[model samples]
Target: MSPNPPSSRALPPLVRIEGVTRRFGDTVALDGVDLDVRAGEFFALLGPSGCGKTTLLRVLAGFETPDSGTVSLDGRDLRGVPAHRRPVNLMFQSYALFPHMSVEKNVAYGLARERLPRAEIRERVAAVLATVGLTAQARRRPHQLSGGQRQRVALARAIVKRPRLLLLDEPLSALDKNVRAEMQLELKRLQLEAGITFLVVTHDQEEAMSLADRIAVLDRGRILQVDTPVELYRHPQGRFVAGFVGSNNIFSGHLLPSGGLDVPGVGVLPAPVGVGSAAGLVAVAVRPESIQVAAADAKGGEGLLHGTVLDVSFHGGSSRIAVTVPALESPVLVTASGPATVTAGTPVALSWDPSSAVLVETEETTWKTGGQAT
Candidate 1:
């Protein structure tokens, strides 16, 4: 089956992976994977190290083949196609520019190999260079440019081929934080202007969230979820997805008599409506910013749980406070704006609307409400 259900639109996906599995020795790198990337879309394969994201990208680029399954691009099966013969370009993280060659020559390398006319190659090279905002640096060698400029050169080289797809492996991993952020925007803009489908492999959740139209979260050779960044962050389908895509304060609880969650020692927290009064919910995840914190002694309020502040970290506009609550196995993290008026060892109260808590399903025994065994 496709990773996602067929869309209502009639346009076919530009790239497709069906039941693809790759294994090395006794280890499985990809397990029965299926995916569809739409044309002109900026898609991301996001996961942590050893998650087989890069392996899948390599498979699409023709550097590696799945042990069992098929990959196709623009309606053609790529089973027997060699890497060079495939109409896809893979850009490495290192930028891989030739130090001895000028920027324009580097960008024209692929076209030269195809034995294109010199005038056509020059025209394409110049046009792509200008598209990437690297026209001024055309005559400069790789060593003469900044890291971001070198990356653009590499991007220009890949796009000059006018390939059906462009595969990037950790494209910004080599840049500093500031430069990385700038390039993220630049890369997105470049993709739009070129109108090329980009499949980027990354371990950085924030990068994937910022650059991709849709992201596929992979873990241990399996896809956990595929959704827009906001959807994945706010409405994750399962526990793994809730924890992986963003930072969340997860509470383990059972269904309560009032249709809320009876979190062990913590007070009953309301669950989002429509979760059903089922006892199958084993956990609920709430973003730190969703919970409100105040001084415990100031007022007694409904839905409020008291705790002692364990630590507070300030990050310009927001502060991350960890509070030790008796009902929780670990400190509950809260992100608040304004001053850090609450310090370590201070008593605080945390409260949040039930609507903010997301039910996360897990493989746990179900317990009925009122502490009754079903």
Candidate 2:
């Protein structure tokens, strides 16, 4: 028998923010931001500091109210819904577990507020604690557990209440790298098992990329782009999206009439697509891996630009080379699969496929002083 296909229904969004704006005195923290969290999907809000990521999270948790918008949960307008009354739970950056309360008490606190039968509360708390792998340490207090353990306890407590929507505010920021990786997996598993909508706010791009089904890249109170991690990486809409999501080497040149761009020393690069400009300033964005470096004067290759190796850094499994092309004002970055074959002050040539480079429109009138194109 064929396996049953997943059901399709116009399931209402678990969380929705419409025309949300938050201001602290004269400083606008969020500006007409709109977002949606589909049921049972892991969605992430990603941005740098002062970009309004956290402020948006606060609005969804009912910790803060929008000056001129509505926050809704499952199609119900949530205006004036106090934090405690809303069917949403927030996992804070600090984890915020009570120091005096044991793991069991911490998880049972919310259930007790609801006054469930004692047996049912105990059973539910036990199940949640086990789900987070903290059942063995039920009697332990916050001080006795490690950072990861404390975080899991916080997760257990938030989940025990079984809220329809779960909000996580940088939930794994404090753990060590290895522990954070493990928790990322665990959190995904728990979210799958629980089948509730999860909306996370984080500045760590890697975390957001790994954990989210889709990401909304925010900046200065505005969402610049929203798409899957792969889509954002492979086909960024603009220079900002390309540079922000990952490392990119950018070069500035003018589009030529022959469907190619002329770099002073790099020669004409045929445009991958019809650019339709003869002398307009343009920026070319390419990832380090896209640029291939070889010994200077390597014969029989198209799109070659010769340069001197200004610096090289070995970063385990791959090496980064900073090459300075004479015509370009700054050095271009290229990543080799293994250790560098050419040392500093040595000559090298860089070549890349026409398809690998993305032409961008420059926003800044003058390039920055350093070699950094971003």
Candidate 3:
């Protein structure tokens, strides 16, 4: 799903989470977290497993109660709100559907429970099934449908109620790669068509980056960063975010007077002037795509670092080259465009623009309400 940027922090909030902390025995699932999701936006909680993303979603869904803090939805406090009463719906990764029920029945189950009129239930179910492209399979049982179809059925059921907020937990993780790709687009289309606020929880970075306009990155029960996909990619705040979001070549050492990293053995790496402290321990992170690599003998003033190409992988439009520099503990990865030009075992020189080198904190930082990085 492509990102649709929210209006601003000033926009009316649909979900307000403040200092919500939940504990299961001695384990702290959520660590004094504060988040605000704007109305009509597709937001994502992105993190690795056991990072409290799911726990936060459950709190908002009213399935789990927080030990401390409060959760408000559309200016209404949800302290005593039951899961069924709240204007919220959760779509699980398993896509739980009644095995004996037909597609239309599954979609109509919620409305039926509310004892709505038969005609109204039918009309709403049919409209939702059509929205998810499942009108043709409305009569099929759960087992008769494909994995993607069952997923669509679950989604249709959730949105048929026209809930104010729809929560999806690893929505497309079960499907095959091809089907997952198709469903991503389908899910976004459904969100726009239904005009429902979506809060998706996924550990897949690419999934969050592709689907959410704003992503809240969580780790160890804390939100490390929240920003647009491009901002998080190009301007990650610290080492954890830089390493987690994508491949980054990091050079760690003392900071020089001219804003360059003074490595003990790898030599100085470039950085923009006035980046950080004049002299102190620091690290410079450079993306693989930003690094320029060429045959060692291929001129251009002795490049920044010299290494031997350890491996080269062709990825259709791009090539991944791993170069082993003797001074660094890990190999430096370079994402060169097009097919491979340099082969393994060949000595190569790597150089990147000074401005591309970002000085990232060695420790994780917290993301607050003022749009500060972590």
Off by over 4 Å in 3: 1-10, 297-301, 362-374
For model 3, how many clashes?
0
Name the regions of candidate 2 deviating beyond 4 angstroms.
1-12, 263-270, 275-279, 297-303, 360-374
Given candidate 1, what's the lDDT at residue 273? Answer: 60
lDDT of 1 by residue, 122-187 (tens): 899989998999899999999999999999999999999998899999999999999999999999
Residue-by-residue lDDT tens digits, candidate 3, 175-259: 9999998898888888878989999999988888878878999998999998888889888887788888878877777667766
CA lDDT of every candidate: 0.84, 0.81, 0.86
Best model number under lDDT: 3
- By summed lDDT, the worst window of 10 consecutive residues in model 3 runs over 365-374
Candidate 1 TM-score to native: 0.92
Question: lDDT tens digits, residues 1-374, model 2?
Answer: 01111331255567778899999999999989988777878888998988999999888888888899898888999998899999999998999888999999999999999999999999999999888888789999999999889989999899999999999999999999999999998888898888777889998888888888888999888888888788777667667777788888776666665455665545665456664343445776778888888876533443367778899999999999998876677678898988999999877878787788776555446443322444
lDDT of 1: 0.84
**Model 1 worst lDDT window (10 residues):** 1-10
Residue 175 lDDT (model 3): 94
TM-score-based ranking, best first?
3, 1, 2
